[model samples]
Target chain A: MESNRRKFLKVAGISALGIAGAKPVLNAFASEQEEEAQHADVEIRKNEKALTARQWAMVIDTRKLQSEEDLKPIIEACHKTHNVPDVMDTENAEYDEDNQRHVIKWIWEEEYKHAFPTKSTEFLDDRLKNLPFLVLCNHCENPPCVRVCPTKATFKREDGIVLMDFHRCIGCRFCMAACPYGSRSFNFRDPREFIKDEDRNPEFPTRMKGVVEKCNFCAERLAVGKQPACVEASNGAIAFGDLYDPESEVRQLLKSNYTIRRKQGLGTGPAIYYIV
Target chain B: MLELTVKGSKKYFGWMALVLGVIGIGFCVYVWQLISGLQITGMSRDVSWGFYIAQLTFLVGVAASAVMLVIPHYLHNYKAFGRITILGEFLAIASVTMCLLFVIVDLGQPMRLFNVILHPTPGSVLFWDMVVLNGYLFLNLIIGWNVLEAERNQVPPPGWVKPLIYLSVPWAVSIHTVTAFLYCGLPGRGYWLTAILAPRFLSSAFAAGPSLLVLLCLLIRKISKFDPGKEQIQSLAKIITYAIILNVFFFFCELFVVFYSQIPEHMDHFKYLFTGLHGHGVLVPWMWASLGLMIFSIIMLVIPSVRKNETTLAIACIAVFAGTWIDKGMGMISGGFVPNPLHHVNEYVPTVPELVITIGVYGIGVLILTALFKMAISIKEEVAA
Candidate 1:
């Protein structure tokens, strides 16, 4: 009986060791299976209701820009959403050039001559020449700003959206110089100080001084299945959708209208289109 | 070696005191900038870069000019440059330090500078710039210190230093080339977007740097019994003369392309620099003065008698130094941004605090230079004795 008990004990000890070692082996196999089953990036950024796009593009219909007055609400929406500061220290100083040194903008109006300097002629149509053109970040496919940022603070999303991480930016202004559109702005002073309490958008992150910022194409709102603030406020003047999708409204608008992009010859592949 | 710096005459201490005072004032102003943001400076949304970046750009050329001496002495076996090669390396050390300081001050988030290293992006020219500039600085410091130490001890620099000295020749060229890439690679800035920018930068660098060396050698003669050699001075003058001629030739090449093509994008920036654009060109007179001075120096330096004579050479070197400072240092940066991307003519002029802050950086550079040069000069004197 003692011999039998010794054999049983040895068997039990070996079995215990086998099971203990098998636990890690099983876990390793399971992890490998899990990785094979799904992409690593799939685990991140999950929201069932979120809007999806292959590539974001913007269509600005200058035909719909009836007057300079039509630009106000769209500008207001973008500025309010982004917390872009008025450096003039006045609430109604949008066009003021007195403090051009500290001008910070997300979206604003431009004359035809300034917006398309190469295209504008001395004897252009009076109405076309007089109309205010909407301008913002081109969010180029070959973004020079993204190319120049040393810190990778400015980056392009897979969906062809150029965005900035304010926290990571060293504010060296290399990106500002790289941007061919004059779309980027540097905060010469504390941006928070320039913003009013009521105008602050709680949903959006307010920026600090000493960072570069520009139009983000309302990526935040898109994550919640809403269009860009400017697009919503534009009263059908602006269309935002996936350019890569042929069936998308932006692609439809692009096909239907005769459109042009700024500095197209420079080959940055600007995403902001002007429907002339 | 450090003892050489400590034991100096009363004038040396007075000079140290003055430099310290400037640094103290600059520190206070910098603290203000840190708190108040860059709003204290003259940089604008349109002209995003201003005086600080310009200074750094100019100094990169100065730092790279050490290669001029290195190539002559090491490769061509031109023995006259052997004496002053250490001086070139030491000047490079000082210039690179100033370059770094200027970069730090220009940063909106100076505290977060290490992010460039932490999140290294190989595609960015700026990442390459930081790498090359810092590498050049390290190489110069190591090589300069060891060589001078060997000179004092009356022994050859260790065998390891030879490879590094050879490495530094190409490394010097890389620093300025990468710096030029910072400007030329940008699409919109017509003034900086030329393939010739790098070559032009090098030519101007060779001119400004060797001329400054000439001035320093002359000053050294006044202070000590040692002369860097008259032939050496004349050789440097020839280098300066050729460099200035090439610099002018490069500028004219750019001008021809801009005007001959009738490209508004390119022509407008030059117009703003040379003449008043939209009746508001603060830099017009300055640009003309720069051109005139460069021409005068070329004339003076090309003549054998003028360059050979200590007095005329000193004057010509001063002219080249000042002229190049205005052209490459002052105009190159802000000129690119005038008639900004949207074709707005927003000019940039440095504020008083900005100018004072700039002067302070120069003071620190000079102070470092004085100390290093003193150490070098002492060793030379001891060796001569």
Candidate 2:
């Protein structure tokens, strides 16, 4: 056993030397275009016609979502298209004093006061005071969840969308702690077991037990030149566009309205803005 | 040398058998958990981590406590610690083994654990924790085994081991620090975001680890012909006294900052822990009990007359151990999750199977410690004869 360990260490040491030897040679042959592209502030789109930017962002118009009924279609569309599991049985499941349960959710509604606990005040208008605000992953430019993942299971794409690679997740839940937004969910059991057969989207793959998952902002949809399921269903309530593009609807909306973000004081640079 | 464990007193064999029995049961329960998933545990979407992670956090301190002995014996040239230093290292080995086990059992995908190493993320604190913890375990194993071998042979330890021994000291500090970073560096959890978390962890670990060691030393003296010596025990008590005092002071410093600021994000967690926040206070009793024990232990330890008596000292050390165990293991992790991202207080209670698994892991740690100490003590007895 000792000799085997020694042999492994020797091989590892030689590999380290090989990598160190190859690094400078690899760097020396870098193309001028590639170097200039690396320095470019804007992302060079694969297809110039596609709505691509260095950072993709979302702007939610909570005013348009006047009632709980207004949110159902958007949420249902996202959940159905993404094959998100419906494990929560709120009526039947035993709940503690905190009303917590073993559940999976990619997006949901929360009271404005609770959703913006640090920012909201008690003396707001009665309609706004009792408003049910939509909440989901902020897709922060500096996502803490991505930073804390041991397996690099969750990572931020160059377009600023946080992506979850379900296969790589070890289900350690470190990202759960790191994400202040509480956007991530772990599949405690086989999610497929909880999902209804008719509701399941055969087009999308379901996750297995023991992996953390969260909203990917429908990066797959964006790849295929389709709007996010929620955005398509919101009927102008939600605007999905590039934050880096001056002509984008989201950028225009942000310019015209005062928008707030969840825990912006932490300097995570959250991409999801709320037009409260 | 491996056979040394086989020949033991009937009581020793009985104890080993009992621990093995519990481990057998625990293994069965762990298999159930693996098949059914973490759904059986009380962990919810809000409180993602529960009892297992808490135990992992606490045992990391116990593992890092070997440095308490290593620092004095090697750096300060304290000769009295030479006899008990191996005991400390062996304890660390056992503690780390349990830490690793707790991590594995807590994972949703225990099979995918190597994905951590396979990916080798420098960005993640969990990755660093894996690195430092595995590194510390091996360091202690190599140092403890070689040093004991040299002692048994009645020769000086090999020259290479001296550097490794020195390396283990800072390496011990790194383990707890990385563990603290796992919580403190998170953006959302106001409770663990304090700058003092790493130092607080180290101080509390210094107190808790040495306290456990001193208790173990007393136990060894009672059970075996070898005595770790009164001087070594007393020195360890002194270390615990100063460390526990500093640990308590750091806790108050944290309290002051949170209360004075009056920020709900920061203050809400303390409110939940010390007092019920928004009518949820499941952990209040445990938190207060921890505080009471810590105060009582510090009072007893500070008074020389009380501390000098071995019986009183043992009781005080037990208090310190239990107090810090509840604080670091239960309150710290759970409190961070309460008043979760949505400003709701979620409570976590370990299920029966979860408790059994936890006890089983502790049994494994004890079994490992017993075997290592059995080997060491037999060698010491032979050397003395």
DockQ of each: 0.62, 0.69
B1-385 in candidate 1: lDDT tens per residue? Answer: 7778999999888999999899889988999999988989999999999999999999999999999999998889998898999999999999999999999999999999978976889999989999999999999999999899888889988889999999999999999999999999999889899999999999999999999999999999898767788888888889999999999999899889989999999999999999979987999999999999999999998888888898999999999889999997789999999998888888899998888889889999999999999999989999999
Q: What's the TM-score of each model vs. the native?
A: 0.93, 0.92
Instruction: Give per-candidate clash totals.
Output: 0, 0
Q: How many clashing pairs in candidate 2?
A: 0
Best by lDDT: 1
The lDDT of each candidate is 0.91, 0.89
Cα deviation at B267, candidate 2, in Å, is 0.9
Clash count for candidate 1 is 0
Q: Supply fnat for every model shown.
A: 0.84, 0.87
User: Candidate 2 residues A184-267, lDDT tens each?
Assistant: 888887888767888888878899999988888888778767888899999899999999889999999999999999889988
List of chain B TM-scores, one per candidate? 0.99, 0.99
| DockQ score, prediction 1 | 0.62
True-structure RMSD for candidate 1: 11.2
